[model samples]
Target: MSADIKAWYLSKTVWGGVLAIIASIANIAGFGISGAEQAELADGITALLAAAGGIVAVAGRLVAHRKLK
Candidate 1:
C-alpha cells in the first residue's frame, strides 16, 4: 500500500538478487546450464551480483555522508 513498499518490489537490485539466487539453486539441483550458453549465463550472474554489491556499497556511503534520504 505504501510507496516505499512498492518501490522496493520494483527495485532492480532486489530482482537481480532474486534471479541470482534462483539460478544458483537451479544449478545446484542438477539443472545447471551447459554448452555454449553457460558462459553467457555465468557472466550475467556475475555482473548482476557485482552490481548489487556496488550499489549497496554506494548507497551505504551516501547514507553515512548524509547524502541519501
Candidate 2:
C-alpha cells in the first residue's frame, strides 16, 4: 500500500535469535528443546511463512483492479 512496503528487511537471523530465546524459556520450563531442534523449528516456520507470503502476494495481484504505478 506504500512505497516502503517493498523496502523492509526480512531476516531469518533475527527469527533464529528470537527462537533461541524461546527455546531457553522452554528449557527452563522443562520442555527440553536443544539448539539444533530450535534451529530446525525456526527454519520450518520461516519456510512456511515465506510460502504463505508468496501466496498472499499472488492472490492480491490476481484480485487487483488497478495496475501498479
* Candidate 1 residue lDDT tens string, 1-69: 575574454455565566667677888997864433544555566667667877998888977946545
Give the Cα RMSD of candidate 1.
Answer: 10.3
Q: In candidate 2, what are the lDDT values of residues 1-69, reduced to their tens digit?
A: 465554222446777888889988988998988888878877887788878888999999999999988
* TM-score of candidate 1 to 2 decimals: 0.44
Q: Backbone collision count in every prediction?
A: 0, 0
Each candidate: what lDDT?
0.64, 0.78
Segments in model 1 whose C-alpha atoms lie over 4 Å from true places: 1-33, 65-69
Best by lDDT: 2
- Tell me the deviation in Å of residue 58 in model 1: 0.6
Q: In model 2, where do residues sit more than 4 Å from their true spots?
A: 1-9, 67-69
